[model samples]
Target: MIRTATPADVPVIHTLIRELAAYEKASEEARADEKQLREALFGERPAAFAHLAVDDESGEPVGFALWFLNFSTWRGVHGIYLEDLYVRPEARGGGHGRALLTELARICVERGYERLEWSVLNWNRPAIGFYESLGARPQDEWTVYRLTDGALAALGSGR
Candidate 1:
């Protein structure tokens, strides 16, 4: 029971995001606002999309995957970059995570995308093993960098 998420699901999605952060031991960092989520997903131009997985019997959402498209200039093709994927603790081992990823892979293949990629915390051994078992290899040679907080503002101001 997996389906694309609608704007109505924003609250549930936000709750799940908090849950994910808590699971990752970064609950304080989960500061997503529901209104902003709605605007992002259902605005004039959406920035991202989400898919929800629900319980077969109860019809209650059990997990979600948020993703967006990315362009690979070298490959001259588009790719899917998964931003977040999370399943409830009680729903662990139920195949929801794999199903979500499988759907994303299908989307990539069907659309002729070059890749489906996401990042995982190095300390999450279980998640790393799960992704490896799915034939996802880490891009160990590439280093990730970010510009945020004061640095991002300073750059924006050309200071």
Candidate 2:
């Protein structure tokens, strides 16, 4: 059962986010707070959106897909840039990941999005292969850039 997430979904979503970080061996990056999530998702103007996957019979959350809208200058269309996608280890290979991806893609198409994009850590070969199996190709000519901490400081240096 895939459905748009609401304020009530935050606690488990937060836990899932942490689980994903830990799976990637990036637990240090999990800094989300409940108050922030609530305001962001249900505020007067939302900053992001999320979808949750739950067990149809048990009613327990199994996974999530969080994303934000992005504008593609070249395509002259909006794109959906997925921020996170995760399914519990016990649930992997059982079709939850594919179901979530499929639903996200369907919603993207329904919204007339020009692209659906995301990235996986280079060391995660299984995920990479899974994405390739789904027919997604790497943007070889383009390199991902981020402006964090020192990088942001350097940008301010005007060098």
Candidate 3:
């Protein structure tokens, strides 16, 4: 079963995030603070939303998807940008991942969103194949960029 996540699920969400990092070979980089996660998800103005996928029989959370809305100026529509999607290692191959993605697509369709998109590490061949099987194509022409910590602070300092 897939359902929207509530603030009470922050701890589980954080744990799943760490699990995802470990799967991606970046366990040390997984440093999401639980309090911050709760605040971000349930604040006065939420920055993102999350969905949880649970085992129907056990009622245990098997996976989660965190996403936010992004505007596509060219398309003149808002799209869902999935920030993170992770299924527990033990729970993989159980259709949980696909179910989460299908729910996201349903959300997009119901809301009239232009698209549902997310990024995957190039080295993750299994993930790549899974996404491809779902008819998701990579945007090869586009490149993602980011500025954080010092660089971001420097830019805000006005040179």
Q: Estimate each model's TM-score.
A: 0.97, 0.92, 0.96
> Candidate order by TM-score, highest to lowest?
1, 3, 2
Q: Rate the local accuracy (lDDT) of all candidates.
A: 0.94, 0.88, 0.93
Model 1 Cα lDDT, one tens digit per residue, 1-159: 789999889999999999999999999878879988998889999999999999898999999999999999999999999999999989979999999999999999999998999999999998999999999999999988999789999999999
Per-residue lDDT of model 2, residues 39-130, tens digit only:
77778888888898888788899999988889999999998888999999877887888888888899889989989999888899999999
Segments of candidate 1 deviating more than 4 angstroms? none
Looking at model 1, residue 134 earns an lDDT score of 96
- Per-residue lDDT of model 3, residues 26-114, tens digit only: 99877779988988899988999999999989998999999999999989999999999999988899999999999999999999898
Model 2 earns a TM-score of 0.92
The candidate with the higher lDDT, 1 or 3, is 1
- Top-scoring candidate (TM-score): 1
lDDT of 3: 0.93
* Native-to-model Cα distance after best TM-score fit, residue 41 in candidate 2, in Å: 2.1
TM-score of 1: 0.97
